[model samples]
Target chain A: MPLPPSPPRLSIGAVAGKTVPRLADLPWLIGYAAAFAAAHQAAAGWGGQGFYSLLYPAAGVRLALLWSRGPRLTLAVMATELIVQTIAGIIVPGQAGWLTAANGVARPALTYGIVVWLVRHVAARSQSSLGVAPMPLGLAAVTAPVAATMAALPWTLFSPELTGVSGLRQTVASLTGFVVGDLLGVLLIAPPLLWVVHAWQYRPRALHRPTLRQLAGLAEAAVVLGAAIAASTLLAEIGLGVPAAPALLAVAWIGLRFGRTAGWCAIVIVAAIVLPFTATDLPVAERLALHMSLASIVVVGYLAGSFADAQARAQSDLSRRDRMLFQAERLKTLRAMSVAVIHEISQPLSTLAIEAKHLHEITVAADPDIAQTAALIDRKAAALSTLVRRLRRFGGRSVDEPSALPLSALVETVTALTRAEARAARVVVEVSPIDPDLVVFGQEIELAQAVVNLVRNAVQACDGRVALSAHQNDDRVVVMVANRCPDRREARPGMGVGALVARAIVEAHGGTVERVTHADGTICATLSLPRPGAET
Target chain B: MTLPANQPDRAAVYVVDDDHDLGAAVARLLCRHGHAAEPFLDPVMLLSVYAEAPALCIVTDIMMGDLDGFGFADRVRMIDPAVAIVFMTAWPTTANAVDSVRRYGGLDYLEKPLDETRLLSAVDEGVAWSRRQRSIRARTAALSARERQVFDLLVQGHSNKAVADILGLSPKTVEDHRAAIVAKTGTNGLAQLIALAR
Candidate 1:
C-alpha cells in the first residue's frame, strides 16, 4: 500500500477511545444537533405530506458525522435530535405526530450503520485506499436510492387521502421525488461537508499559509468556474435551457489541474450558482433536469481529481527507486578504485621498510647514530603499513572464489573491525555467540563489508548499545543488527546510503535485508542468506 | 663465506611477489641472515620450475596478477606435500589469516613491510617444519600395512590389548607388529613414535 497523502490527526476525544458520551462531549453534541435540526426545518417547507422532502440537506449532515467522527459522536448527535424533535411535535402548532419525529432520528441511525459497514468492508477493501474523493463518492452512489425509498414508504402508507388504487400515482410521485431529492442532496452536500470535516480532523497546529503559486491557482480556478456558472445561468434566462457540458468541463479542468480540494470547491461553487435558478417556480421536470446536471458535474470532478492524485504518487515512488539504484552503482565503483590504489601504494611501502632494515643491519657496529636513524625510518614505515591495512579492511573488493564461511568467524571479524568506531561513539556493541558449524556460502570479505556497514550504522544511531547476533533459522542464517531507542517517538524511519549498499550486496548473494521498527522503539535490520546446501 | 643459495645443507627458500623490489629486498634480508633465499617476480613463473627443484619453504604474495598465493600453495602441496608455505599480503583480514592455516596448508600468514623479527622467526619455523615432515614421510615409507595399523592405534593411545581386539588378532601378534612399527620408523619408543606421528 502507498502512504496517505497527508498524515492523519485525531481529536483528543477520539484519541481517548471512549465509546460512550461523556460530560466533556456535551457542548460538541449540542452544536451538532442544532446544525442538523436547522437543515431539517428548512426542508420541511416543501416536504410533501411532511415526508418526501424536495431537498433533504439533513441527510448530508448525518452521513458526514458518521464518516468523520465515528459512531459515538454520531449517536450522541442523533439522541439529542430525537429529544428536541419529540418535544417540538408536542409544542409547535400544525406539527406531525411523535411517530414522524421519531422516524427522522431512526432513519438516519439505520443509514449510518449501513454506510459505515459498506465503506469499511466494500469500498476500502476493494481499493485498499480510502482517499478523500473515491471512498465517500462510492458510498454515496450506493446508499442514496436505498435510503430514500426507506424514508419515503412510511408517509406514503400512512396518509388516508392516498390509499388503495387512488393513491398509486401519488405513491410513485412521492417515491420519485424522495429518491431524486435525497440523491441530489447527498451528491451535493455530503462531499463538501466530508472534505471540511477531514481537513479539520487532520489540521496542523499552525494554519498552513498557502504559497504564492497556490493562491494564484485558486484565483484562476475561481475565475474559470465563475464564468462557467454565469454563462449557464445566462443561457437558462434567455430560454436556451441550462446546458451542463460547458460548466462540467470547467470543473473537470480545475479538478485535474488543481487537485482534490480545488476541484471539489469548483463543484460546490457551480451547484450554489445553479440552485437559485432551479428554485424560481420552474416546472418540476425542468428542476429535476437541473439537479441531474449538477450531479454529473460532481461525479466528473471526483474521478478526475482521484486519477491526478494517483499519478503524482506513482511518480514519487519511481524517483526514490531510481535514487537507490544510482547510489549502489556509485558505491561499487568506489570500492574497486580504492582497492587498486591501496594495492599500488602498499608495494612501495614494503620496499621502504626493507631498505631501512638493511641499512640498520649493515651499520649497527660502525656507527650507532646511522643505525638509530635507520631504526626510526623503519618504525615510521611500519606505522604507515598499519594504516594501509586498516583501510583495506573497509575498501578491499574481493575477487576470490566463494566458500562456505562459518558464521561465528564472520561475526567476530565484523565486530572487531567496528569496535573502534563504537567506542568513539560511546556505544556498546554486543554480539551473541553464533553457531560454530553454521555456514553461508559467499565471498568472506564482501559479506563482512555488508555486515560491517550495518553494525556501524547501528553504533552511530543507537543511544547506548547495539546488539549484533546471528542464528540459523531453518534453511537460512539470519544476522540481526538492532538498536533499542530510549524513546519510541524518536525512531528514524528510512535507510541511509550505507544501508542501501548493504542491501545491494546481500541481495546479490541470494539474500534479503528487512528493516522493522518495534513498538517499544527497537529498530532491527536483519540479513538472511541461504545456507550452503540451499545455495541459489 | 656463503654464496647465493648454493650451500648444500642450507636448503632453498623461494620468495614470490609481483613487485620486483619488494621480493628482492625480502630475499636479500633472508640471505643476509645466513639462509639460501631467492626471489621470483611472478608466482606463475615460479610454479613452472618449482617441481625441478622443490624448495624447503616458499614465501608468496597473495594479490599477484596470475595465480594467487593460496592457489600457488595448493599446487605446490600437490607436487611436494612436505614443502612448507607462508603467505604475505598488504591487505590482511581475519578471513585471509584463517584460510592461510586452515585451507592452504600455510605455516603462517604475515602482513608486508614484514616485521623483521616476526618474518625471520616464521621462515625459521617453516624450514624446520618442512625438514621434520620430510623425515617423517621417509621413516614411515618402510612400514608394512599391519605395522602401520598398529602404529596408528598406538599413537592414538591404545594399549597392545586394545589394538589386538580392534584388529581381531591375539595380544602376541599385536605386540610383534608394534615392535616392527618402532623398528621400521627408527624411533626410540612409544613416546618417540607419537611425536613423529604428530
Candidate 2:
C-alpha cells in the first residue's frame, strides 16, 4: 500500500513564533489612557466641545505611540480607548457611556488600521533601501488626518457627543471643528512626539549629550520660540487676535540650524509658546480657525524639513554606491593583473630552470670540479621558481567560485597532494580520519589551495613532520595543520605570499586562518569555515 | 652511479609536447644518452601512433595544445597503467601536476629545458620501475598455488626450513619453489625480492 500520503502541509513551517507583548507595552497602554483622559478633561475645562477644542491631543498621542510600538498593539489602543471613553461618558451629562463605548474600539481600529495598511503598502511598493526615505512617511502623515476624519464622520450620525444637539448650522460648525481639531492635533503633535521618543531611544549615539553644535541648534530653537511668542502677543494686544501664521522665514533659520529632528522639536516649542493666544476671549469658531492656521504652519514646516532630510540622505546614498562600484572594478583589475603576470612568467621560468639544469649537467660531465658556475645558475633558477610559486600563490587568481564540499574529501585530497613534498623534505604527514558526511560551504579549489599552502608550509618548517586534524563545531569545521621544529634559531621567511593568499581565500569564504608559533616551536595553522547552508 | 637500465634501447621513452623544438631537443638528448626515445610534438600525434606498442615510459609537458600533459597521461594510463611517467613542464608551480604523476605510479618530474642528468636519471628510474612491475606480473602469472605460498613466505623473510615447517612440506620442496619464484621474478636474492614485494 502506498503509505497514506501525509496530511498536505500548508508549509507555513511553524507558527511564526507568536508575538508576545512585553512589559514595556504595559507602560505605553497605561500612559496612553492617562494622557487621553487628561487631555479630554483639559479640553472640556478650557471650553466645552462645540466649534473649538482647546487641548484636543488624544488622537496625536495615539499616532505618536503607534509610530514606535508598531500597529500590532491595536489591543493596547482599544483597551485604553475603552477605559477613557467609559469615564468620559459617565462624566459628561446625558451621554450613554456604556452604549457608545463600542465606537471607541471601532474608531482607533479603523483609523490606525488604514494608516498602518497605507504605510506598509507604500513601503512594499518602493525599493527597500538603506537610507531614510521621507516621502513614504510623508504620505503616512497625510493618512492619519484622513483616517481620523473618516472614523469620526460615521460617529457623527449616532453620537450626539460628536454631532451635538446644537442647531443644524451649529452642528455643521461642530463637525468641521471636529475634523479641523483632530487633523491639527495629529499633524502638530505626533511628529515632534515621535521625534522625542526616537531621540530618547538612540540619544546615546545620536547626540551623546548634545555637543556645541547641538547647543547652537537649541539656541536657534529658543530664538524661533521667543520671536513667535512676541509676535503672537503683539497681535493679541492690538486686538488683531492670534494670526497663527508662524514667521516661516525665522523658522527656516531654526530648521537649517537644528537638522530635521531638532527642527521638528523647535516647531513644537514655537507652537507651545503661542498656544496661549489661541485660547483668548474670542468666539469658539474664530479661535478654532486660528488653531487650524497654527496647525497648518506646523504641518507644512514639518513636511518641508522631512523632505530636505530625505533628499540629503538620498544624495549621499547615490555617491556611496558609485564610489563602491569604482572601488570594486579597481580590485578586479588588480587581481587580473597579478594572475596574468604570474602566468606569463611561469612559461619562461620553466624554460630557464630546465636549461640551467641541463647546463649544470653538461659542465659536471665535462669538468666535474669546475662545474660550480653551472651549479650556481641552477640554484638561482630553482630559487626563482620558488619565488614565482610564492608570488603566484599570493597574487594568484583564486579558483574560488563557491560550492558545498565534503570535509573528508577536502582533507584527504590535500594531504595526499602534500605527501610527496613531505617525503622530499623528510616530513611525515599524518591525517586523522573524519566523518565523511560533514561538509563546508566554500570555494573548492581555493580552499584546496589554502589547505595545500598550509601543508606545504608545515613541511618546509619542520622537516615535514606534520599532522592534520579536522573536527566539526556547531555550525563550522576546523582543520588544523601543525608542524614541530624544536630549533628556535633557524629563521624562515615570515611573511610569505602563500600564507597571505591562504588567509585571503579562507576569509573570502567567511572562514578564518590563524597561525601561531608555540613556545616549543610547533607552528600551527588552523582554518575554520561555516558548515554548508548555515547562512553565514 | 649506474642504474639497472641494461637494455636501454629496448626501453622506449615517449616524449609528448606541443612545442616541437622542445620535444625534439629532449628526444635528442635522451637518444644521445643511449635510450630509444620517440618525440611527438602534439598529444594527438601520440594518440595516432597507437598502432605501435606502448612505451616503457612517457615524458610529457604539463601544458600542451588542445590535449594537455595531464590528458595525455590519462590516455596513456588507460592503455597501459604499468608504463612509468615523467612530467616536463614550464609551469612547475601548478600544484596538482607532480601529485597526479605520483598518483598514476609515475617515477618523477623534470622541470623544463630538460637537464640531461635529471632527464636521464628519471628515464632510468622509470625504466627500472616499469621492468620491476612487469617482472612482478610475470612472476605472479607463473606461480602455482603452492609456489605462490612458498614465495609469500620467502618475501616475509622466512628461511627454507621455516617455510617448509609452516606449509607442512619437505624442506627440499620449499627450496625448489623459492628458486622458481626468484628465477621467474629475475631477482638476484632475498633483498631484490623484498624490494619487488614493495
Best by lDDT: 1
Q: For model 1, what is the alpha-carbon lDDT of residue A388?
A: 80
Winner by TM-score:
1
Cα lDDT, model 2, residue B79: 74
Residue A529, candidate 2: alpha-carbon lDDT: 90
The top-ranked prediction according to DockQ is 1
Q: In order of the candidates, what TM-score does chain B achieve?
A: 0.88, 0.72
Chain A (alone) TM-scores for all candidate structures = 0.60, 0.61
| Model 2 Cα interface RMS deviation (Å) | 4.8
Worst 10 residues of 1 chain A by lDDT: A1-10
Q: What is the lDDT of residue A359 in candidate 2?
A: 83
Candidate 2 colliding pairs: A354-B112, A354-B113, A427-A464
Tens-digit per-residue lDDT, A106-196, candidate 1: 6665655466645544543354444333544545543744564776576567763432213666576556666656665665666788767
Q: Considering the true interface contacts (CA pairs under 8 Å between chains A and B), give the fraction that model 1 also has.
A: 0.54
